[model samples]
Target: MTRASLVVVNYNTASDLRACLASAREKLGDAEVVVVDNGSTDGSVEMVREEFPWAPVFFFGKKGKV
Candidate 1:
């Protein structure tokens, strides 16, 4: 278990999420980054998983085909 966690809720904002995660990583080094994707077709979940593999993502709502 992590001592702290950062929870991010994303919709179709993949680019923004990525930027936010990058900034978050720079700030919170040891904190856990948790992402909750709300059925984004813009491949938000996939981008996060691929780009920021350290962050654990919790998928919700409709899953994206992309």
Candidate 2:
């Protein structure tokens, strides 16, 4: 199987991120998921970390660019 990477940039949008992850999980199997939090104050990083522990989470500083 081919390996894939899913990169999701979150910015105070928790619901959308959850939905996106759910859909990704259903469609892509055995793929790596990466969630990049863009200094979101709505607990987006924590939510993703708790829900998708398998995925690697990255938190950028204020106005930080990737």
Candidate 3:
């Protein structure tokens, strides 16, 4: 079976991202969760690193580079 990835693009929304990831973790079974951070200064990247270590994070450390 081919697995699907849930790509979530984020900025400075740490709280929101946390909630989203939490829900995904509880519900998404075998579906890879990928986070593409767009240079967030509000600790979004750090939060993901600490909380969702299983999810891969691709951080583009320059805002607006979507």
Best by TM-score: 3
Q: Residues 11-53, candidate 2: write the lDDT tens digits.
A: 8999999899988888998788899888888888898889989
Decreasing lDDT order of the candidates: 3, 1, 2
Against the correct fold, how does model 3 do in TM-score?
0.89
Q: Global lDDT for candidate 2?
A: 0.86
Predicted structure 1: lDDT: 0.88
C-alpha lDDT score of every prediction, in listed order? 0.88, 0.86, 0.91
Superposed model 3: Cα runs more than 4 Å off:
none
C-alpha RMSD of each candidate structure in angstroms: 3.8, 1.5, 1.4
Best by lDDT: 3
Please give, for residues 1-66, the per-residue lDDT of candidate 3 as tens digits: 527779999999999999999998888877899999999899999999999998889999888866
As for TM-score, the candidate ahead, 2 or 3, is: 3
**Candidate 3, run of 10 with poorest lDDT:** 1-10
* Residue 45 displacement in candidate 1 (angstroms): 0.6
